[model samples]
Target: MRKIYNSYINNFTGLSKEIWLLSLVTFVNRAGAMVIPFLSLYLVNDRCFSMPDVGWIMTSYGLGSLTGTWIGGRLTDKIGFYKVITLSLFFGGLGFIGLQWLDSFAGFCIGIFTLILIADAYRPAIYVASDVYSKPENKTRSIALIRLAINLGFSIGPLIGGMIIASIDYSSLFWIDGISCVIASIGLFVLLKPKEKDKIDPDSSIKKEGLPPLLNKLYILLFIIMVLTSITFVQYFSVMPLYWAKEHFLSEDLIGWLMFVNGAIIVIFEMPLVGYLERINISKTMATFWGGVFIALSFIVINITSWSGVLIIGMLLLTLGEMIGSPFSSALALEMAPKGRKGSYMGLFSMSFSISHIFGHNGGMNLADTYGFDTTWWIMVGVLIIVSILTIWLYKLLKKSPTFEGT
Candidate 1:
């Protein structure tokens, strides 16, 4: 146990001071975010919310996230990254605490919206901070380490949530989540040191060569992909447990453990793999990763039998694919960003997921209700396959285009 803890601590040696600070923030924020996976369950099962009502509540959170991302990006540019991060943490932690007091539907909506608003605000600042702090050679790894910290936090959060929910009331989950944010807030405040300001390259010919406008096109394509992929990812939160409960006779305890397993695998392996992949052709690697997601999702489409062990195996595959796509897409978005517009650029990337959640969470529930989980999974698989093909096509097109920035 001591050796394991030491290994985890030593992982930071490869990262710079700012990157380490960002990692701490990511871990804590994600630890707080674990409340989301079981949030639907809390609403419907615990609070007796109707399906449509749950949709609206989640939609409100997504809408708030959209606004928050824009605001966060704008603030980071004018004020600075550390201020934005600190404010986000303080307010976000308050929002989590607020969840404990929310009993009515309106109260739930308000609480969730506030939480997402603050939480989403942290994203762009962290990204821009990573970009500012690291040299080009380590930029991708810095981002990956940030993600790894979040995933590691995610790994622990759900397991802890599971144990807490099993033993206590669902409301207790909020307190656990809120406290994590507070602890992380302290760490972030102490660790983040401002370095030299990163100014956009005014003389860089790329903006003049049409790179700025090209991002809008990539934005559209990526949005479609995000909507499709998020439908599958949201299942881990929204509908999958219900499906297993209704169709597979799986207990909530087992479901929680499965979710924990998903996070644990990512925590253990996502970084090493990302570090390795950073040295290779990122676009091609992501295309292949999405292909794997398509195949892993097919297991659900073709799923007719009930086997807990097999389901776990399928989840491992899905997570493997997710790990590949997450960091690759983030780096791509960072690369696509125009100078001085890092916030909006990151805002656009953040918005993709928010928009996707609007569809993926609420729309996914509707789809699962109208069709079955099996059919829903098939729809997701088909879209993922399409995304993989399109990503590859885009890669080829960018390679040939004279306007492409990063080779």
Candidate 2:
């Protein structure tokens, strides 16, 4: 027991204090993220929006997210990550606060788009910041810490959010979400001043570079795989709640507890898992391929049984897949980035996920509304199988790459 405890502590030892602070900021911001987990429920139950309308609204959210990441990446390169983060937090907070007043379909479309645009700009900046803040050796662990913070906060938010909705109302969720961002903004602004390296880059660096690394064929294929895999994984958030409610007649809090199970499992296991994988010198892409297999199996588990206990089984498998894949996949992207263009590369990396948001949520919801949740689950299994195959191909191709040959 003592040996295991010390090993776990050692995994956390080398990261910079700034990374910890940055992760704390992430936790605070995400801790109040009550609105998203239950957003579909709110739309269906409270606003009475049809599933098709919800899909369109989610599409707008994706567009906004896509645009936000692009702009944020450029802004991070030009003005610095600090300023970009500030803009995201402050404007995102105001947007969340403003969202409650918009109940009409058009209003929601515009509001969700604008709100996500502002909030998601934080994505690329934070990714770049995570890379910059840590020692090269500690980079993966640092990113894991940020993810842990996000997951830990996500775990708390849904559990508490379900209770809050039961007691107060969905509108209260918006207020708390908005207020938390505001508080996060204040904390970030007051405490975190990044080093001078974060400032505007020398334009000559881009000139010295030939084609951008993000435009590489290897990079593009990797991005596509991320999109497909993310699309499959994202349904858990977008449509899984509907599945639980409509199929099993679960209450709001029960759904929250289930979501909590996913997040908590990730938080508890991810860092140590990442550390162990790093020490073992495993192939990152191969790890991603295996993780995709688990993600696919998660969907398959639903069709195997109607027992509600299967939700736990699927969640556990999904969480394991996430743990196995996420950090190594991140290391791949970051490793591919050229020194001066980390923001641009990370921006492109982050964009893969944002693009999925547009397709994933809308497509999953549409499928659920059309064919029923079982079909949606089966379809996801098919999609993830493709993702897994592509990941394996990428892994093989990377083994031949001049850069990866040595590593």
Candidate 3:
């Protein structure tokens, strides 16, 4: 037992202090991520918006995320990840505060759009920073550590957000979230200094040489798979809470606990699990396939059981799938990116989730609203099955390419 514990500790210890600081910043920021998880429920239940309206609003947030990452990627290459991350955290925090005053649909749309656009720009910058700071062999574990921080924060956020909602109004969610972001930004501003290599000039000839990530054929296929997988995965935020409340009559506190379970499971298992998988030389492609299959199974099991015990089991499966798939996908993107364009590649990769949110929320809500939850789950199963096939094909194709020869 001691030997195993020592090995796990060594995996984290091998990383740079910069990586640990970045993870701390992520943890602080995500710790206050109270708004989005409850956004759909607040819109539909509190604001009395229709399901379709909620979908459109959520889609608008996605649009902002897409645009944010695109610009952020370019900015990271041009300016530096440090400045980009600092500005994003500080300004996005202000956006969250601004959201508290908005009540009309147009106001909500504009507010959500602005907040996500500024806030999500942090994603690619952080990933690029991680890649820049870590040794090549530690890249995957570095990303996992950051994810661990995220999940740990998430484990706290929703559980507390649930209590806040139960006792007070929704406005508190925005305030707390905004406050957290500001504190994180301050911590980052004081502690995070960019290394010389990370300070690439925008107009430098080397920075401009590589093809844009979107134009790469292999990356495009991977992006498509990302969208498909995220469509199923993102429903946890968009629809699952509403399902628990309306369909099962669960309280907000209970729903919060459910979200907590998702985050907590990842916190406990993600690093060690990812380390084990990578150590075994599991192909990123196969890991993704198995993860997607488990994700699909999670939904299928939910459809089959109403018991809380079974529901908790289903949530565990969903988190396990996330632990398996999400970090590896980012690591794979890092592996495939050209040397000078890590920011662009990571940006496009991050956009995959935003695109998923756009379609998944709108589409999933439409299905649940029209055909019911059972139909939605079955359709997700079908989507995952198709995505799994594509993932396998992508793996085979990559194997044939000289660039991806040994992968």
> Per-residue alpha-carbon lDDT of model 3 for 8-107, expressed as tens digits?
7766768999899999999999999988889999998889999989988998888899889888887887777888899999999989988988889998
* Candidate 3: 10-residue stretch with minimal lDDT: 196-205
TM-score of 1: 0.87
Clashing pairs in 3: none
What value does the lDDT take at residue 334 in candidate 2?
81
For model 1, residues 1-407, the per-residue Cα lDDT tens digits are: 99966655554446777677688777877786667878877788888987667877887777778778878977877777778888888778778877877889888778777778887888887888888777766777788788888878887777777778878778887877777787777777777655444342222222333244225776556555655566567666676767666777766566677777877887777776666565564563354446446445635633756665677777776777777777777776777666767766777677766766666677767777787677777777776777677676666656675655343
CA lDDT, every model vs. true structure: 0.71, 0.85, 0.87
List candidate 1 stretches off by more than 4 Å: 1-14, 195-215, 282-302, 403-407
RMSD of each: 3.9, 1.8, 1.7
Task: Give the top-scoring candidate (lDDT).
Answer: 3
Residue by residue across 85-188, what tens digits does model 2's lDDT show? 97799889889999999978988999898899899989989988887777788988998899999999999999999999888899999999998898888888
Clashes found in each candidate (C-alpha, N, C closer than 3 A): 0, 0, 0
